[model samples]
Target chain A: MSVDVLINEVGPRDGLQSQGKTLTVGQRAELIGALVDAGISAIEAGSFVSPKAVPQMAGTNELYALLPAAEHVAYSALVPNMRGYDLAVAAGARTVNVVLSATETMNQKNIRMSLEQTTSVCAEIMQRCRQDGINGQAYVAVAFSCPFEGETSQSVVRSLSDRMMEAGAGKVIIADTIGAANPRQVTGLMHDLVGSISAERLSCHFHDTRGMALANVLAALNEGVREFDSSIGGLGGCPFSPGASGNLATEDLALMLESMGMDIGFAAQRLVPVVRTAERLTGITLGGHSFRWLARQVESEEQGGGA
Target chain B: MSVDVLINEVGPRDGLQSQGKTLTVGQRAELIGALVDAGISAIEAGSFVSPKAVPQMAGTNELYALLPAAEHVAYSALVPNMRGYDLAVAAGARTVNVVLSATETMNQKNIRMSLEQTTSVCAEIMQRCRQDGINGQAYVAVAFSCPFEGETSQSVVRSLSDRMMEAGAGKVIIADTIGAANPRQVTGLMHDLVGSISAERLSCHFHDTRGMALANVLAALNEGVREFDSSIGGLGGCPFSPGASGNLATEDLALMLESMGMDIGFAAQRLVPVVRTAERLTGITLGGHSFRWLARQVESEEQGGGA
Candidate 1:
């Protein structure tokens, strides 16, 4: 059976935040515009965290102001707390993404909040989002494994997901923050998740640190997960994890899905120019494992045209 | 269910042949000895081709003389014709690997022989191998896609496989020589293969040209095909396909398989030293997509030990 998958482009927010080279708001807008032109419907355009903490995502509000409001595109931003949520709402963000760490140690390390404190903060933000007619998606970071606390159990993730849903989250994304997961782990965790949560409201965000991101995607697809988070040119990595690679490249994921006869709403080849632009702006060599192969295809095409 | 998988290391034969620097016979022996110590049972140690043709494989006879014939190890050599097969027998190779391309263009370009001529030669070699009481494994190169031929039909591969087996090949390896096959293509081809040929007599060799090798492995595993061909440090690309990456790394394959609860007879961590040696010898940057992750693990282990 043919499937239509939703690819949420997270390059502007998740990808840029971890990069060393910071792009200007105009560059971010250009990247987003290219992605929108390529038929990406959902875009995590920016995050509302403190500029002092993350300088790369500092001018997201200005980026939002400069962006064109496309008819089919849904722009979202990451909000860490109630203050950030207010700032996001003021910035004209219609959809907000909130992240809560799955482990207590991770919560302590990342945002310096206990699980109870984080849950209350998320619930308050979700409640405000509902009242303001804004969509809210909760991301459970380190859902698979944590670098500090080690193996995270599925039960912990499930309980956190349940609390987020109760707190008015419309969607929940399970993230492998450190990229330490295997396909069997994905199959086991997603099998349990699909039974408790509907596939419509569940998504997966994977890091390609261990080269299993696409394999994990195949595993999740077997469990009926249709929504995935990817970055253009594979531009993001966890700030806490040293020497880790970026997120799975959007071009690689798109290529695999299209090859499998699944429709992802955009032409995979159209993203090559976008990837090149990202590489130029960020000065980070972005491309997934299939980057060289895609570059070869482009080279061959140009030569063919020249001939 | 606990599954035992066979990992055939092909760095010496397949990897070295494509590399720029040629390792001495002593270095080749040392690499093979390390692999044997790491519990790799089957190894394509060398080829019996002319030194004038492939200088990298020169002095393989001397390497065989220096190697200690371990009880569990099987040292096989690639034999392209009757003369090469005779050399392999003289060198005390108990098992010989014979190759025939699936596409006509690949056969003509690679071996300078037509499909019919290659088949007859392979059948003749297999028949002699049977008389000599030696094991024979036939490799169907470019079984998935050929660089010269756009797409190779499964029917052609199937017919060639039938002919090779009829002529006394004990095992058959389906090779994606150009590393152009995706998971869906692997699933489709392997599904038919597993039904026609017993999984016991079938193996898969994949190159990582497009970064889908491990994903294709997962697809083949789902089809009950267990044996796979890997090279240390991910060495060995197709000599015919320029700009292509090496074969699937033995360390990466071992890591994924062991993590998935499959017993491959040894620890995946044991292959790191072998990979380092391969890098030093071939001077080709080895290691697959998970190279950084594996290196980090090694660092952590060393630090933990010092503490």
Candidate 2:
């Protein structure tokens, strides 16, 4: 049942950020604690960003401070710039994720920086992470299609990925931020990326906005890229992208992968309680495609011993 | 732009039959008319089952009578048995869909018959359709997993498919009736099915229960399946299967296929209005994965010339 795949849980960071209400430091720690209990080893706990800009992530450092460090568990934080990276490092973050949009328009809109400035910023972040002995994962946002820029060229994404790697990023995550990627586009990009960058160093981050996240995941899996970023209860969406939906639901992805006989290293049944906790905290009826079905299974189990 | 794929619209039959309120025959006809106008040619217009058994599908004949016939547009009806077949033919149905469960438990529960009895009934119905010069599509429901029986055997599905084809079924649709199929299972079954049956004579019907329907479609497409059954606005789910979600949303499928540059004949843009109409009629917000994104595109077009 060991399927050699890494499910990097991003719910604590990505899932909670876009919500209307913010979870207290204790509440965020509880959610992350539940995920670790459910056997999710890797978690993006929070981001080191301006509280004035993203107030939801204000107490990230305290949230991390309160967390119980465990064996086989890795915690990472998103660092937007040099200051964010410095803050993350000071907060005892051992791994940092730096993001830059793939297209010029998105880079400008999302980070208020030109593509050149964003890449330069990313390179500096990656170099700092390398110098500080922190694992650096760089993200190419809107890797498939930008909300403002119709289609992103593979060449552009490829060059940016190359630059991030050259600048000492340990891994690169290709993100369909707008959730607009289809399987074929995913295949085309992954096919090229896998050839140029080792599959071990490449991952996929997708939103379920267009309901193609899992499909795109399958495409990446076929290309031998095994690492993926998912959120609990299908939380997270790019605030800048109009009509964008949530991130690929962790429970949904777990169900598909487990059904396919891939050992995702966590019990899908165990994630149900985690999702329920998320729903209670967010006060949103949180679910992915498998949410209802899983709930039914849980109910059946309660009524009849097991699903 | 000419990618060959048959999108068999199943909204009128499958979509409506599962709703809380049944649309009037006039309302059903108008929906079908709108679909036809949107350039969808194959529609499962209604069912010929006992109205007492499935009151939602009552007055199907009248619904058919109200439909406008057009060149290249084929209207089919779901016929449960010889009686339903005869009724469908009398109502001028050119094509008929006969369904048989792949599992013994489902067969007994759904139709109050054993597997042997159901196949015999299907053979008789297929023979009748052949005699009446009607095209017949046989469905192997719960082909992947049954709610009561759990995992359905591939051999059981294979043998039933062979018998249906031998009994004069023009095509056999492999349905993940309870929406329990993942891509690997789909690929395994399709890999074997395609070897035994020509790809042209094989189609796939999937539900998005686990959000893997489109991924399953991708698997089938890789195995050379060009025909798919989709409900407009993701409107159908099996009433027998507790907590089952809707059929693979036509808009979602069309978006994926069309984005891959496949000529799905109809534009994804046109399906937006149809989905809006479906929402209006069902008194439910209907959408696929790309529903919100597509709606935004339509809105932008209205404001700024056209998309």
Candidate 3:
């Protein structure tokens, strides 16, 4: 891992897609604007999918047109299939991410396909990204544990990741779909992945379900993976996983990295206001586990008792 | 680190001592009994202090007598001075712990002693334990940060830990008195500590104030710490630190260690009800961040949905 790390904020996409209330395309742009102001360099802007399946992601093409500072920010979009990918590329999305579950049952439940079929579809999309010169990413969802299957096979994940890479995917993010990953599990799996794929092309997506997300992050960091996916104010959870909690909170991740003296570019203390803004936009009371302490720091600084 | 880790429950002492309400000796013993039934082996039963100073620890001597399974379970008490030490030994306490703050201002505010004076007193107590054939322990409180003093010196902590060991203390616990520790900080300090003093003779006490307690635990474990101090239901905080939250919750630590494939000597799922009993006893709502998921696991198991 380098001294500087990458923070990929996914609030506008992964976070909002699961919310009960759908945000207007305008309000979604406003949230992205606030994130850019908070110094988030990379973000998952929205998804290109059927509005009927995910109503919250309606009008993503319009939202992309209204995003702030297109020249400075690295904004990506999620695409479920070839049609979604075409729509995303047409909307001028330079980066696109795809999801492939490691287990057959999870693939059936999440996207209504078999594991093999999902892999084929994702592989085709990655090849298309290479042809189109788009920065392509793939998420190995439920990579650690499955609600339907107890423990996912590491060999299967490795093979799937290798196929994605061979198909021209730029990165593979190991996601804890049910947030059932432990540090030991992370260390064991990440050790294998980093050895096979090299660290620069790997990232991690964790949920705080069992409250081990940060610990798991440390484990992955120890294994040389740096880039991480998180949502502002810990905005979302898996719709299919019953006991799974929110995605690892952006402020918590930033605060931890800042505290460690690592460089993530943005000042974590400033993200407090962005969390409040996201809460207002979504009508969901949201805060990371460290929200209280982080707010107190911001308050103390406001009172001129600077840290 | 060993495959098996020791969970040192400090709820009855460090947890209760900071509470607003004081439980009767009988109530305290009942809480200890509940933890014992849940498979906790080592517990800080209470402190031998002036009742006027800390009313919650008023009947520690009486509580000691009512403890269950004296031979099977290991019970330790905190002693502030020679008088408290004499009382603890008189009450049949075989193990006693002493606290030494790592900062001067903390020592002044906590025990009305200078850091040098406090160290000397703790050294005397530890020496006394050696003469009396007792298992002696010392806590380097505020080893990470002091409330009045921002960041503590690592060299000072190392020196204090060394002195405690030299003074015949069986173990020295590195305490994050205000919960301002990060995993990187933990890794740096523990690397020094584990080198100076062997891992088997060291312990860690953390608070969840900034929500990185588990991450810090992982860092310490990486540096070979096998013993940790946590409280049931995250019962208490340092009465002196403004933003310091509760001690690391016993269930959270146990669950993380167990999930990491380590042997922590008990089923973490069994501690959910124990947290409930603690909340009822303390009249404060308490749960670790993972409490909801843990409770769900217990419920699933009760319904005979075997994992």
Candidate 4:
């Protein structure tokens, strides 16, 4: 197993943020701790945002305070603006992820800002991260294709990624916010991204809305992306984006990665119990077909070839 | 738009094969006709296998005979044996597909044969296909991972693919039979494939079980594979493979391809109606997330507001 890949778990932040029943600060911390125990190195802990805008991520600062401090285990907080960044830093988040869309339509819909304005704000946050000795990851949301906008151009996506890189971002996450991208688009954009930025400095975030997130990731991976963002048990969706399914499931992605002999330092089978817990807590279906099948498989295995 | 993509619609053969309700010969022809009307040039019409094993694909010769002999349509059948190939030839099949597993366990369970025996049979069939002026395509099942035996090696996958290419096969389809592959695996395999064979000769068949089918396709597309197998409304799963979901949806793949500005000659909006028809016919949910989302989007557009 090649220990070259970074599996950035996003279930705590992206997954829980979608559930209507928000986990308390302690629960969030526990979840993060569980992820750490499961051998995940990087984790998106929570987003520093207004409770009014995103109630689920309200107590992220408190949750971050409870987390065990470790050098190898990097906990990241999502921030949209300077205020969010300041809150993230105050909460002891050494890694901060700032997100903006590549298209104007998504920028307006997601954050109520223009692309230029979002880029400027992200740049400011990047500068802050650099000064504070924190790692900054810029999430290029809707980098593939936007729900509001029909298709995002490769040139626009590349420009946003380049700006984020220029702004001192440690890594740029090319996100398929709506899961509307095909392999060609993923490869094309990643090609443009790698041309300006190093492949090691790129990450991928994908939604399984149209069930192409992993495929998009593969396309990007072919272009040399090593880091990926995935939710545990597929417990995520954009609350703002009504029809989205979820982020690529962390366990499932890890399973695929490990099965391919890529060292992601995680076991998918070990995470099943956590998935069940999340499902019980949320009362929402996690992965539609795969999870149920996995449950039956384990049950059948335990039954020992029962009729 | 690059007009180079060849979408081999497997809805009739693969999609219906896994469904509960078996369409009659006429109904199957009508469905294939609808796909032809939608401008899909290549199609896997049916599989010539044992009636008991795959009742839905029974009497494939009858269905093949019933299909419209359009000049543009490249009607084909999945041949399991020399007898099946003879039946397909008698039915005027211009193209034939043969399946082989990269893993020994899968080949043993699926075809009850060793990998060597399966490869040898496929080779013989390919030779026969050449003599009969048929374009023979070999599908490397479990190319990424096997259900019974997990984590298929790249060497095993590549050797099988190489054998298929040497067997006078016109095209080779690398299938993630159990949907146990990630983007990294997909790209890594495609990288190997592209180096050894022409991209034009390679195709991909993916299942959406773990929701990486499209991502795998994207990676394959990045490596220059233009041909792909997709089921209409994402209908079809390997009955032998436990917990497997259907093939990558034709409409969804079309959507992503078109969104990327590559011309596969599929209209997602037009395909929605056919998908609905398929759901009605099969009494199985197909494209539940995407179809519902697309319908609402269209309805909202028609109403001049959010639906």
Candidate 5:
């Protein structure tokens, strides 16, 4: 199939999980509902992780129970191991995204497993996903650069990505966990990745830590990779990666894409209010320099001033 | 001369001028001193606008008097008109930057003059600069999009840029006053402008309000336009164009440029402390997602865990 751009809203999962605050299952359901209304067709609803580590993602099953099923929207949960996969499947999650690191150091630091062990665990999860008839999306975190292991090699990224693709995984997401990838690196790696793997079955997950998420997205877009993962108000920072910021703000990414004449279904204008809500919810102000300017443009237009 | 990169540090002038609370002369001098020590060769030290309109910039002459004279550092000030130019020259400013709007509505809102009137005034200022042997740079604010006039055409930008270049402007910096210009539009316009004008004589000042400043910079860099105006820690907002945040952060821009193997002298590692000091002085967050990440990277390396 041709590359069809997909925006996977990870607000409810990656966003809330990053913040120390925990929301009730009902709140996660409501946030998901808001996203569905906003025309986001795919969402990483929740992550099945140890509550000891991330309390916000504790009641993933309960949140899944509360989610309103829609025909168009594909809701997925992050499953780290076979146990997480089983739990996600039992919660009626049709899609499960398994994550592993390419480097031994990062794999050890993130999940206390070596690269080989992590890959083996992911293979088991992928087998479980295939047995349960659930679509498995594997993500190789720190595909670009790692805090524990700097300068993640493109060959390693490609090797792991190929492994996941062969292991009954329906798709793969390349994540720059530490936000260290520049445009040249992104363009070069993406060009190679897309040539080897179908860009349609690939997604790019970026952290805005280095302020290069949007630029990286543009690079991937040029390479014909359609799917992207962004958090509302840029609310998701990596727990393992110290000082790394959240994903790219959905509003900011949508604005850039829409301005470039790429038809992302979400309306960039409507997202300003939601970003304000997110800002109020979390005192951390998100977005690049243009957030307030675009807000003013929308506000002035509403006030009948063509600003 | 070989390819030289000019970084016009605007934090002191454009940044402090827009804030509600004005800094003392000592504090302003300290800020400039820090930037100069950090290897910024050109600093927009202050603006000679009216105290009533811009109270923060009232001590332009005081700041100029105390500035440490260095052979490499070129101190400039904003000159709105002939009176402003005279004040700037009297204050010992060797380089004065003049501002004029391309559209009539913006000109009316900004300085209460028609485009023709503004052009005539700018021409007089240019003639005075020529006679006085002072370098005058013209900034075409709202060159990409006008808040009051809506979409600003490329023809207007080209016309204004050509006139400014012809009128003794050593360099003409194009301001995205409302932060609405995307990569394609900026690239396309720069392509057109570069054909008529040397990229060396051009600079781009972009606001990150739409999260496209870095991408826009990448586009301009690819076009061979090296000179750029950025605020330290992303200080300053467009006072005339409300809701537009600070120009792209100097550290962020330097980080990208340095990583790309481009020889821009400002070190991204050294800029963090400068940003922290500025943020403390200004009482406004010098915000960027990458700031903390960079700090952590440094700290981790210090702890023997290289990032």
Candidate 6:
């Protein structure tokens, strides 16, 4: 099937990292199974972070080993530093991701490092991944706004994104860590980024905290971005980031894309059951804004109600 | 105050008409007062229809008479026919609107009239508004997709809109009656509509049932639409129209526009209390997707926590 956009499901990593309940490796594997069944090919499976720091991501390595080994399925995990990158590589990970905060205060608060130090460490990880023949990706976190520092400098985000790309990162995901992005901001930043680094290597991660995620996605898509990061059922946000309410739900993104006559490689309505499964496993009442209308679509179809 | 967009509030009419509980004319006046206080300049006060058929709008004439007589606040009303139009003008209405369903099935089902009959009636009303020197507007209902007839013909919408304009309608509001519009469709149709009719005489009314309302708004905004119809707190949809769900909330639209540095003539945060008043009046939980984040901004500001 032809795919117009590549959606990297991040429920297993970014979504779970901020969750209250820690799913066991087995439970995490179950979630992945449901996502694959719904026609997801690329996913952020887990992270190589410390179990003590993020209990929700504790069993990432074991979860990776248990994930489906389908040739088309691309599973990636987050690595904060060299040790984490080594653990990820030892666990048979083919793709490794590193987070590079764009602001000085965000770096200090998140990883107790200066912006310069975090950027260097991330660049090193990306370089290592390239040497080891791994698909290296970097996230420019808080690319839009910092809760403590107000609006981030556009030039700063631009410089760091260029640095990550220079360090052999195959892709740079611009992440709105605090969900403070609006469409105009997304369009302006995406326009500059796509022009400089090119759109083929760029993706966006937006939060629906202010109900502009889908709009942000549209702006980026218009600017030629072909990939995005979404969570199943709008699962989670960074625990350390205030007001980063919900990740853009996979169902919402998929439905909007498909409804626009764009192919996403699956029937968007089929994800109704997958959202239910996510809710059951995590014990969290979850779904995107479009979940109810999507569920009704499945119901109407089952009862033979014609469009 | 400078205004980049003209928001015609429909809560007093469309918002209350479908409610489970009917508000007295006095209470509806109170809701309008709240909207006006929040910097709303244009409002759809109510409809001059058969009282028994729509009891919620029974006391519209009385309500209009009681409303504030501020020169800056432009209020409008809906009129179904010549008799309704006369009633509206007699009630001191300076602006009047009429609904012209785009699909045959919708016309038959909603008003027991053929599409041609409804169009003629609406055209006559617009013509009359011209002779009377009143501001006339026509709504092309279900302009994107109709529930009973599936996709509405774009050519039919274009021709009818032109007819209404020729007959003296000052503006044509392209309404997504069932909340089924996508950004792709919106962009394509709006491009043609704006090109043919020019952007100055057009507006859009979107519903949030499928979570693409804001996206649609952005698409239309890019096409040069400077007017929109919104309901306070996402108050109501057509009771007769299935799947219409929630009207685009005024607060959500205002916030997104303001965040993008566009002037919407009011502080978006000030709508928090307005939404609360709506909830209190209707006895329903209401707010757009941005409501939570908007509330938090207000809270943070009150606590002197600088953004």
Q: Which candidate is the best by DockQ?
A: 2
User: Which scores better on DockQ, 1 or 2?
Assistant: 2
Docking class of 2: medium
Candidate 2 lDDT tens digits, B9-32:
999999899888889888899889
Residue-wise C-alpha lDDT for candidate 6, range B95-116, written one tens digit per residue: 9999999999999999999999
**Which stretches of model 5 miss by more than 4 angstroms?**
A1-4, A49-55, A123-133, A238-244, A272-307, B1-5, B51-53, B127-133, B238-244, B294-307
Residue A10's lDDT within candidate 1 is 95
Write one digit per residue (lDDT tens) for candidate 1, span A1-307: 1238889999989998887778889989988988888778889999999999999899888988977789788899999998999888898999999998899999998889998889789878888888889998999999999989898989999998988888889899999988888898999999898899888889999888877888888889888999999998788874434324568889888888886878898777778888898888887666776767777677788889942
After superposing candidate 4 on the true structure, give the runs of residues whose Cα lies further than 4 Å from its correct spot: A1-3, A68-71, A80-82, A101-120, A144-168, A238-244, A288-307, B1-3, B100-128, B140-169, B180-202, B238-244, B288-307
Model 1 bad stretches (over 4 Å): A1-3, A238-244, B1-3, B238-244
Off by over 4 Å in 3: A1-3, A238-244, A305-307, B1-3, B238-245, B305-307
**DockQ for the candidates, in order:** 0.49, 0.60, 0.55, 0.37, 0.45, 0.55
Q: What share of the true interface contacts does candidate 1 keep?
A: 0.43
- Return the clash pairs for model 3, or none: none
Q: Chain A TM-score of model 4 versus the true structure?
A: 0.91
- In the predicted model 1, the residue pairs found to clash are B233-B287
Real contacts recovered, all predictions: 0.43, 0.74, 0.61, 0.49, 0.72, 0.62
List model 5 lDDT by residue over A1-307, tens digit each.
Answer: 2224678888888888877667778777877877777777888999998888888898999988888777788899998888888888888899999888979998887778899999998978887788879899999989888877788989999998898888888898999887778887888889999999888788999878788787788778878899899887677775435334567878778888888767777677766776665655555565433466567768879899553
DockQ for model 2?
0.60
Q: Judge candidate 5 against the unseen true structure and give its global Cα lDDT, from 0 to 1.
A: 0.81
Q: After superposition, how far is residue B283 of candidate 4 from its true place, in Å?
A: 1.3
Residue-wise C-alpha lDDT for candidate 2, range A1-307, written one tens digit per residue: 1347889999999888888899898999999999999999889999999999999999788887987688788899999999999888888999999998988988788778899999999999999888889999999998989889799989999999999999999999999987878899999999999999999999999888877888889999999999899998787774424324579989988888888988888878788999899988878767777877787778888999854
* lDDT by residue for model 4 (B1-307), tens: 2366788889898889877788888888888888887777888999999999999998888887789778877887999999999988988888999999898888898779998899999989998888878899999889877878788899987888888888789988998887777666778898899899889889998887765566667767777889888888878874535334567788777777776778776566567777777777777767633555555566667799633
Candidate 5 chain A weakest lDDT stretch, 10 residues: A237-246
How does the DockQ of candidate 4 come out? Answer: 0.37
TM-score for candidate 4, residues paired by index: 0.84
TM-score against truth, every candidate: 0.94, 0.95, 0.96, 0.84, 0.88, 0.97
A86: Cα error in model 4, Å: 3.9
